[model samples]
Target: MLRRANAIAIFHAIRLQPGISQREIGDRTGIDKSTVSAVINQFDALGLLERVADESRKGRGRPSEGVRINGAAGLMLGIDIEPERLVVMSAGLDGVPLDVSEYPALPSESEFAGGVSAAVAAHLARGGSTLAEVRSIGVCLPGLVDRSGKLISSSNFRWGAVDVAGELRARFGQKVWVDNDARGAGLAERLFGCCLDVQDFVFIDSHSGVGGALYLEGAIYAGSLGIAGEIGHTKIVPHGRICQCGDGGCLSAYISGPALRDAFRGAGLVANSFAEMKALAEQNIPEAMGVLDEAGEILGLALSNFINLLNPPNIVIGGGLAVLAPYLMPPAERVLRRHALPEGLAHCTILISELSKEPHARGPLAVALQGLSQLNADGAFPW
Candidate 1:
């Protein structure tokens, strides 16, 4: 058990800081140098790690070798089912994407599992890869997913009580994992984005709708029902616009992509989509600016309430929200300064996500990596 724990620690250290020296791995993971060496040798023997020339070496008598996870070791599959599209991504254990493919989303909830299976097969065939090469499969759904991998409901798709994990497992005969899309994005931040070293933070995803995920003490807090971070549904107005979730005055109703576009259209703006609205805002159109300003203020009010309750050290704005950071952040920050508790506000820093392109796809990749790690810890890992 102790040895396994040490191996996990050393592996994570190497993963977090690829090309790290054995000594540095030991320092980061708190494992003894000898143990680190042994683990590195074992990993090398298993074809899990590769040694590279330490480029940072200066005035070295003998250049020390740096170790990193091998990109060719094996592949993990990530599937993201969104409202309009299904994205399938394949990555190595090192978290580098090998291939990504997009397809039209399934017509309805009944076709979700089979549709995903067909997409995965097509993606693998297109990439000249096979299921045998995949170590695990992770799925991201835009809805309420339980700890057991059951999707309880998704207001966007009107889906309910779907056994996402089981269905996928039956199709692929591989270990499968599932979670909410927003929470999956949080995992992606932890694995590959700005929050790599942050232990506590909030991730807000504003795309088709606004969603949130909470990461506390280095783990995602899914709450008792695995739906703890539905910040979008948090009531911000008493009886404002109706949200897709059938609730009035919800935060999503005010700032979601569709809502913003509709608001712009209602105000006599010529924007057709969220991207168009962003372009209009960039052009300094008065109508677009006014709509965004109002959305930003409302978002700020909700964020202020969130800060007061959680007091997280960081809040990462992602998805479509990141695109509007220039127009939205200033007003949001102003409201936060005026309304948030001083103590909490002082400690919190709001950051725009850096994963701009194919961000949602990365979430499921993190989920796959995390599921693989847990399986390894349990000694049930197949590859």
Candidate 2:
């Protein structure tokens, strides 16, 4: 299984850079030349890899062969159901997104699933690839998702109950993976983000709600019931304001972007959305700045407490509210430094995630990829 994993890693590397030579693959992958040769040869024999004769470096002792991934080997699918729309993407085993599509967010859970199925079918009809080619499907969702890919609830959609995993599996007839939006973003950062070099970090989303995903010792900590990083639900003011979760004083009650927008309106400002808040902030509107400042303060307090408790190496802030980092970072840092234990506070660093796609949605795609590798308990990447 370890050897197979190495081979899959090498294959994925070559897939990342098509037409790569064996020496280059080995050099980049840190795998031995003989191992690379054996893996390549084995893959060739299986018809899952294609090698092309190369004459470009003919003068260098001996010629080398360029290798490319067999697109037909398999495909992976990612589905993200946000508040406003459903997003779908198709990628190769290499994790390169080949296609993307979106549709109405849906008025109900069943409607959401129905929209996703239709969107996926539409993408497949484009002629590049079909649903029959998909080996695994990962879903990014807005709720507490179990390790088994079941959704506990969705605050945004107000979904009280739903068997999302079963529905998706039944519809697709393929392996299905489900994960919380923040958790999925953490995976995206872990797999491909600035935090790649750092372990034990937190990934936060600062949008409609303040949520995060925790990575401990280089692996995500989903906690019991997969609610590990539900930071937004943590009580902040101890009774300051009523929250959507039927609780008051939650961090999300005061710090989420949407909450900030509401506060702006209460302050005699008329900002209905995060975009308006951003524009208002740019105009140096005192009300807008005040809302962000308060949010930063709460966020800072949350981080300070989090830093003391977890002692993570880095605190990466992402999501839409990250746009406000520049304006709010100072106050946020002030609160963090003021509240955290000196040593732990000083030791931790804060950053923002830099992913093109919505991280919450992309997270499940990563779960699907991992599930593809673990279709069997033997612990191997499917090739």
Query: What is the C-alpha local distance difference test score of each model?
Result: 0.82, 0.74
Give me the candidate number with maximum lDDT. 1
Lowest lDDT sum, 10 consecutive residues, model 1, at 374-383
> Could you tell me the lDDT of residue 35 within candidate 1?
87
Name the TM-score of candidate 2.
Answer: 0.82
Instruction: Assess every candidate by TM-score.
Output: 0.88, 0.82
lDDT score of residue 36 within candidate 2: 88
Off by over 4 Å in 2: 1-74, 126-128, 356-361, 375-383
lDDT of 1: 0.82
- Encode model 1's per-residue lDDT on 232-251: one tens digit a residue: 99999998889999989999
Model 2, position 329: C-alpha lDDT score: 80
lDDT tens digits, residue span 116-234, model 2: 78888887787477777887788887777776667788776688667777787789864777777778877777666666567678888766577788888646777766678999898
